[model samples]
Target chain A: MVKNRQWRLISFPSGRPEASNWELVETEAPEVAPGHLLVKALYLDVAPYMRGRISPQPNYAAGVGLGEVMVGGAVGRVLESRSPGFAAGDLVVADFAFGWQEYAVLSPGDVRRIDPALAPLPYWLDLFGLNGLTAYFALFDAGAMKAGDTVLISAAAGSVGQIAGQLAKLAGCRAVAVTSSAEKAAWCREAGYDAVIDYRAAADLPAAVAEACPQGVDLFLDNTAGPIHDAAMQNLALDARVVVVGTASLADTFGAPDTGPRFLRQILVARATVCGFLFSDYAARHEAGRARLRRWYEAGRIHSKFDIAEGIASMPDAFLRLLTSRNLGKQLVRLEGD
Target chain B: MVKNRQWRLISFPSGRPEASNWELVETEAPEVAPGHLLVKALYLDVAPYMRGRISPQPNYAAGVGLGEVMVGGAVGRVLESRSPGFAAGDLVVADFAFGWQEYAVLSPGDVRRIDPALAPLPYWLDLFGLNGLTAYFALFDAGAMKAGDTVLISAAAGSVGQIAGQLAKLAGCRAVAVTSSAEKAAWCREAGYDAVIDYRAAADLPAAVAEACPQGVDLFLDNTAGPIHDAAMQNLALDARVVVVGTASLADTFGAPDTGPRFLRQILVARATVCGFLFSDYAARHEAGRARLRRWYEAGRIHSKFDIAEGIASMPDAFLRLLTSRNLGKQLVRLEGD
Candidate 1:
């Protein structure tokens, strides 16, 4: 009988997600049903949004239930298959709840086939996976980014931000990166952003952002909302668009995320749009993102970065580090040894 | 020699305008300069927007300066013409400064020739003038109202709200009017609103609005911003448009207007737009509104409601009445001799 390890939410988190909230559990693998494939996870992504899933607060999605496997996207290999579409040794990405786990048995329809010749396994979790898909929809679909427009991205060193910067460059836009550290600024510049501003170093962020973007930002991708978002609202040009993706700033202050200044009047005066997007809402466009990313990856036009931690037991720690901005790109935990 | 009387601002008011701030200055008849036409004022339209002009705070336009005629729009008869377009005895609408006067001189281009047969002098200042034009653009142009959409108008008993209600109805929309009292509610309903919610009676406005519009509110014309705007933000439908036109709530409040609860997330989550628009911004469309209103007025498809007070000296009291929610429709003043 095959054995698998999975992380279950032991308790709801009080402030930041703690080790006690997550408990690793072992279970016997289910008998392979027809049209189902068994996946052995290579890399599991730890996104900042997952923090909201562990907290006991009203959020866009329900928090992970106590004693349930922590939900996430994973890049894996098809170890065994009872489905016609997949076979042994095939690589795939799936929106499986088997994250922080060793192996999972999922339906063939749940697994999205990936190209190994184009990119490595972690790229699936970074570029071709949720991060890349989110950046694509938020920037192009939601923000309606155009050529020559100035695009400011918060958390510019993060997985989604890196991809968005490259995409903006490809679209002939002036990409401005707002990062918390100087190292992240360098990372963003290397990724082809026109300008980078260290949000941490500035006393007056709105003035700093305005100085960086003299014409003001036309499009804003807000992942980390705090002082940076408040400044972005003030420095927006006419008909600006702000895409609200994540609230990672909530982690810094425990439960009370800093309430930024009211920007409705500014939005009205500028004729700008501020829109929030849940990734799952665009399921129909997944194929479009997949096709585009595949082309970009095949052409070596985009880069993917992963900050991986080995072992299933370190999943909670890795997620906590992700909340504290310890990881460089996509934060992930690999269960290769277990 | 003809004697001309004009109401000029002697001092700027700290809050609501008072009679002492203005002085009725008598001067010799203004000579028609090159490209300018002489006009004898017939009717001056007193609008709520004038309150914004009297304030010291910076707005979309410059505030009323000391020792200048109070800015307003009026219907007048051309007493003399130096400009090529205007003829003597021609009835026209002028979007110019100092409408609260006996006689004034204006550039020919500033005044739009009106059809007295289609819509009388009062109609041009009411339904076909700035008030009606503002409601049209704010509702249809800026808000992007579509047929069968649900619309909610705050301060529904006011001049702009009443016309907006009829316009929304004419466009085959489900229009809900929110007013101060039961009497105003009845008037709004009689004015052809599909639903009327009395703010004083409804404790839970969002629930009441939801009950009235089972589907959701697709468009919101905001004049009063306080609890009503907050409630409306909570229940906006997918892709809703909230147009912030005026803030009557600010009129009663002392000191700077409170920032209030931030609804930026609500705007984002609903993929909605909250836009602020000024009627003067679309001065080009004034003629179009006049033409449409002319046809409607001739056909009796639309009507104008005016709360007329005799004597231009009563302007201060009329303005106070407008601030206190005592006036039902367009507030105007006529010279006592007329």
Candidate 2:
């Protein structure tokens, strides 16, 4: 009999999640139920949104409970199919709650058919998936981005920010990136960002942003809603648009009182607009967004990097990389690959 | 020569401006320039926005300089005209930077002609002017409030809030008012609000708002950006809209850091939209908006009250009343006869 190994939440976290908060459990691979497919995970995504799911605070989606499989996205190969839609060796991509496992029994509706010939397996979890979709909707729909707009993206070298910067360039907008390390800054510039602010080195973030964007930020892709958000708020142009894409910086402060300068006056003075975005909100248009992103990728107009960590044991550290912004691209834990 | 008695800001206040912060000065009215008109102040307005202008902090407009005439709106009569657009004794309404003065040398372009036969002189400064314009644009343009929307308006007994509440009802929406006193709550009900919460007495303002707005707030007219704003933020419905119309609660906190729960999670969870509003953005639509407001007033479909403080000497206290929300209606300092 084959064994199925999974990581389950053992406790909730008050601050940064630690490796000890999770437990790796081993059990026999469960018998596939009728209309369900038994799949083996190949690539697991480590995304910023997972921080919200593991927190004690309430999130947009239900939080992971103690003893439950942690929720995340993954690309997998169907090993056995009781469902007619899937077959043995067929590859698919899905954001499943049972992501931290070697094998999962999933309903056919839980995943989408994906071909590796179109894109790499990990690409399905990165540029062709939620990250790319976020950047698209954030700039075009939520931000109402126009040509020549000065777009500022936080976490600029990360998967979503990199894609957003490239998309901004394609639309004739100047993109400025905010990152922590010089390595990330170089990557962001290569991704078409006109300027990159190493937030760690920027003594005065607001002034640095203002100097980088002399005309003021017309569109702010707020991937981290804390200090970077505040600095961008202080530099919005008249009628600027702010799309709250993620809260990497506020991961620990979500339930706590986060202190900052009152922004109403600045908002009023700039007549800015703030919109909160979740990729799921555009679920209806996701397939279409993926198609468009795929087209851009083939045209060589867009590119993304995956900061891959090997083995199931690296999953905890892979996810932890998001909190400290240690990953320069889309982070993934690869269990088995070429 | 007529005497021009004006209130000049003598000092910038640390917290709330006291009566002593302003000094009344008497000077002879200057001669009108070739294109200017001499105007006699009839009804001088005291508005919440004036608080922003009086503060030393930079605002949408330049702040009132120390030893400079305080900035506000006024309705007056042309004493003498040196410009072709106006004539002597013509009644006009203008939001002047020198509104506290009894008489002033003016430019014809500085004022708009308003007939007293159309509405009361003060109505030009209230329902037909900045306050009304603010309400119309905030709900219709910025907030994007639709029919059947559940709207929560803060500072509900004040000029902009009262007007916004009545407009919300006229649009077939459910209006909930947030005010400080029982008397103000009654006035809000009289203005067509279905629910009124006395914020001063409510121990848990968020709970009270949630109870009053059982369906959750679809649109929030945030007239004050402080505790009330936070309360509304906690109760937003899916895809709710928040239009910031004032910062009465942030009057003293603009330059200082204001601590509150990090709202990124709350905002993203609800997929909310927040917009900052200013009436000047709708300047081109003023005449059209005034015409609509005048029709509503004539039809008895809308109503507002003026809390008049007598004479130029009372201007300081009249503005001071705004800080404490002591005035139940549109606060104005009357310098002329009824």
Instruction: Using DockQ, give the best candidate's number.
Output: 2
For model 1, the stretches where C-alpha displacement exceeds 4 angstroms are A52-63, A95-98, A250-338, B10-23, B54-58, B96-99, B247-258, B261-338
- Candidate 1: the clashing residue pairs are none
CA shift of A95, model 2, Å = 2.8
Which consecutive 10 residues in model 2 chain A have the weakest lDDT in total? Answer: A261-270
TM-score of chain A of 2: 0.77
lDDT of 1 by residue, A205-299 (tens): 98999998999778888776667777786666655676666555645344452234343322322333323222223445534544443353345
- Please provide TM-scores, in order, for all candidate models, with all chains considered together: 0.71, 0.75
Worst 10 residues of 2 chain B by lDDT: B261-270
**CA deviation > 4 Å runs, candidate 2:** A258-338, B258-338
What is candidate 2's lDDT per residue for A155-232, written digit by digit as tens?
Answer: 776657777887788678999999877766776776668999999899999899999999988888877766887788
